[model samples]
Each structure stands twice: as C-alpha cells, then as structure tokens.
Target: MRKFWSKFKREDGQVMIIFAFAMVVLIGFAALVIDVGTVQVAKRRMQTAAEAAALAGAQDLPKTAEAISAANTVAKLNGGSLIRTTVKAPYQGNSNQIEVICTINVQYSFARILGFTDTDVSGRAVAQKNPQWAGEALPFLNLDDDYLANPKIVAWEKTAPGDFESLWPDDYNVYFGGKFDDHSKTYFTVDFADGITVTKGTVATVKQEIGYIYGQKKPVYIFSLSSAVIKSGKYNNIKNKDVVPLEDLVLLQVTFDSFDEQDKNLFLTTTKVFDINKGEYPTDYLTSPGGTSATIVE
Candidate 1:
C-alpha cells in the first residue's frame, strides 16, 4: 500500500491534461472573436451597398425599369449582390411620396470553419421630389380682352385682321378665345340670333360647339339664361340704339387643357353660374370665376 501511494503522488501526465483543457478554452474564445468581427464587417458593407442602391433607384422612379437596373449595378459594385429591390409609387392621394428598398447577401469567408457560411444583410431608403419642383411657367392672357382678336384689339395685329390664316394660329388660342368677355373677365357665351325669346326669369338653354384636336370630343352646355341681363352704359353714345349694353348677356362656360411633363394633354370643361334668381340679371360675365362656382355640366 505504501508503494502504491508514492507512485500516484509522482504526478505523471497531469501537465498534459491541464495543457489540453487550456488550449480548448483559448481556441473557443479566439473563434468567437474572429467570427463575430467578420460578421460585423460584412454587415456594414452590405448596409452601405443597400443605401447606395436605394438612392440610385429612387432617382429614376419616373422610369421604373431604369431605376431597378441602377440599383442592381450599385449593389454589385459595392462587393454585395442585390437580393431584392422594390419600388413603390404614390398611392391613396399621397402624390408626393416614393419608396425604395434594397437588400443584399454577404457571404462569409474565414468564419466558415466554425459553420457560419454566410450572412444576410439588408437596407432601405425613401425619397421624394420637392413639390415646389413641379411648378411650371406658362404664358397666359385674359380672353375677355380684344388681344385675343385676330387683330388683337390691344396689341397690333402682326398680320391682317380678317385673314383666317394669320389669326392666333394655335389650338390653345382657339380654346380660350372661344369664350365671351366683358371688360377684363371672360365667360362662356353663345349667340342665338334665331329670334329665340329667352325670357329674363325663364330658364333658357344655349349650346356651343367646341372642337378639340386631341383625345375626346363633346359639346358643352350653358343653362338657365334666367340671370342674363342687359347693361346700358355710355362710353360715347353710339348713334344708334343698335349698340347693346355690355351687361345684357352672360357667358357661362369655359374650356381649357393642361399639359403634363410628358406632353400629354388633359381637357377641362366647366359651367359658369353658381346660382340664379328668378328675375335677377347676371351682373358680370367677363371675369374668370372659381371652379366651385361652376359645375362640370359635360
């Protein structure tokens, strides 16, 4: 028994066991540090790539296909492959909004020894054009004035007055000038020289033929000449009673067209009167009125 105890105390091979246990702990800690560092670096790179891709996409939102292509290019250049890209336009009356999202896949290299082969990283970005950027400049004139005349009453006619060829030779001119005018205001008006007795208090209907060169064609209506009145004022009394008072008639319909960025045109048709009393005459018919005052009678 004494000899067995001495042999056991000799500590043969104890150091090897301790050394093996220490090595295992160190290796595990080293693996954690290295793998975690690698993942963090890859994640940062992916995030950057995604941000660049999303911004590139948004800049081309007006051209949806081009935007997607741009995003993918940006992702690839950043050492990441684009996994997904999505672009959404304005919806639900939010006309000024856009959304873009980009995702990328980042593969891991040194961390694979520990079984982490790859990591998925993603990012998103949104952008919108400032509303102020949409406003466009256009030349406009009140149709109520003679400047709209073939020989602009105010401006010299660059050409002969009655020469139909020299008349304001544009579709837009015919559009706005078709309406009637009083003083500086313009109103939709039609003349019925057919001896139609449009009673002052009675409802009267008038029709005007407005022709368009694009899209759709339709006739607009002006209702209830009940508000129509006769105005008599003296500028220099014309020798004959034949000169009609400016207030005697009311123009009530207006038409116009708007062009978008792509040069696509949209037509607008509107009514001219808000309300009319049984015997009340329309006081003014020359000035442009608010849309609220007119109903879309077409």
Candidate 2:
C-alpha cells in the first residue's frame, strides 16, 4: 500500500496537459480579434455607401421614382448593393424636407467559424430644399421684373466700358441700370459701382460674391434684379422697401450657364417651372421647388 501511494504522487505529463488547454484559449482570443476587426472595416464601408446614396436621393426629392433611381445609382457606385431603402418626400408635410434610409449586407471574413457568415448594416440621411435664397447669393440680377413671377431662360449682353459708364453714372444714376430699367433691351453690364448691396460692405465681400458666380461651372441659384421691388426705379428707394440687399429679391432664383468675359455675355441653361412648388431646377436649380440639399440624419 505504501509503494502504490508513492507511484500515485508522480507528476509526469502534467505540464503537457496544462499547455494544451492554454493553446485552445489563446486561439479563441485570436479569432475574436480578427473577426471583430473585419466587421468594423465592413461597417465603415457600408456607412460611406449609405451617405452617398442619401445625398443622391435627396437631390431628387419629391419625385418618388427619380429619387429611388438616383439613390440606387449612387449605392451601386459605392461598391455595395443596397438591401433596402426608404424615401420620404416633403417629410412631415414639409415641402423642402427629404429623408432616406439605406441598408446593406456586409460579408464576414473570419467570422464564419463562429457561425456569423455576414452582418447587416444601415445608414440614414435627411436633406432639405431651401424655400428661397436665404443669405449671400450671386450678385447678378434678372433682366425683367416679370421673371420673378415666372422664371425662364434669359440672355445677358455685355456693355462697352464707355456705354456702361454712360448708362449708370455714379453721380446722377447711382444704381447700375440694366435689363431692369430697359425692358426693350436685352443688353446688360456689371455695375461695379452700385451693382450689388454687399452684406459685409467691404471690397473683399464684393469680390467674393462676383468670384463665386464667375467660377461656377454647375448650375446654381442666384439673386436676380427681378427679386427687388425697385420702387421709383432707383437704388435709394431699395433701402425703404424693407428689403435686404443680397438677401431679399423677388427674383427668388436664377440659373447661370456661362459668363463670357471677352464677348461679355451671360447665358442661361434652361428655365422650366412646372410644379414650381416641387419642380426640377437647372443643374438641380437653387434648392427651392427645383433644388436639392442633403444631410446625414442617422
């Protein structure tokens, strides 16, 4: 009995058994880290796709079919197939609000061993169409007051330096006179002296406004002369009409095509106002009834 007890106390093979158990635990931790990291990468990709889709759809708000088509195109471009999407036009009865929900399936790399073959990811965004030009806008004004009531394509002609100074003198005619004063003529000129009411009232501010419009290649909404009431047909009267320069202009919106410095001509791309309340804009016109803007909500 004493000899049997001595043999039973031997520690042979004990270290091997402990090492085997430790190896299994270490392997499991490695799998968890690798799989989790892969999923995180896929989640980020899905998020990017969702944001792009939402912005694309928002640009075509109020039009159910067009909005969906635009969203799908953007999702596909981002390398992920859209699993599902929800588009709400005029969200919450607001004509300008557009909401979009996007979902995608993300494949797993190392998670298959844990029975998670793939995971689903989702993203959402909301965009609003501004009702009108809110603040600082391009300085160009429309040719006729009638353009404000009904927006359409209008052409602008450049005035010779001599003619520009003669038509819009600084002393007598402080305001730059163009199509707004001469309905019979289509020719126009940039009245640098009193062309626009700069919000900042600085030379830099004036240059900024002009530079923005001149540099734009895409169609965008800008303030036109039609937006102004133009009482007594002068600039001094502009201050009394409760209108803010570069802010309030009945010329709610205008789309520019090209500004030719040499020929001195300004052209418009297109001007069609169907459901002016929810219509399409030129180059997705300035975000009102025919405009678009996007933001991520979720």
TM-score of each: 0.37, 0.46
**Per-candidate clash tally:** 8, 9
lDDT of each: 0.36, 0.47
Clashes by residue pair, model 2:
141-224, 141-225, 142-224, 142-225, 227-249, 227-250, 227-251, 281-285, 287-291
Error of 1 at 183 (Å): 38
Best by TM-score: 2
Q: Candidate 1: minimum summed lDDT over ten consecutive residues — where?
A: 132-141
Give the alpha carbon lDDT tens digit for every residue of 1-298 in model 2: 9887766655445666778778766656766788677666666765676678767776666676777687778777773555566667657786556666666676765556556677776666666643332222234444333453545544333222221101111211111223254322111222332234322111122332233444544444433443344332543322311223332233233466565544444556434322222432234333223223556554
Over 1-298, each residue of candidate 1 has an lDDT whose tens digit, in order, gives 9988777766555777788888767766776777667667766776666566655554554456665676677767774444565555441233333454555555655555557677665555554433111101011111122211221111111112221111111211122334452322222322322211211110111112122221123222222112322122221122211222223322223334432223222233443433322333244322232111111111
lDDT of 2: 0.47
- The positional error of residue 10 in candidate 2, measured at the CA in angstroms, is 7.8
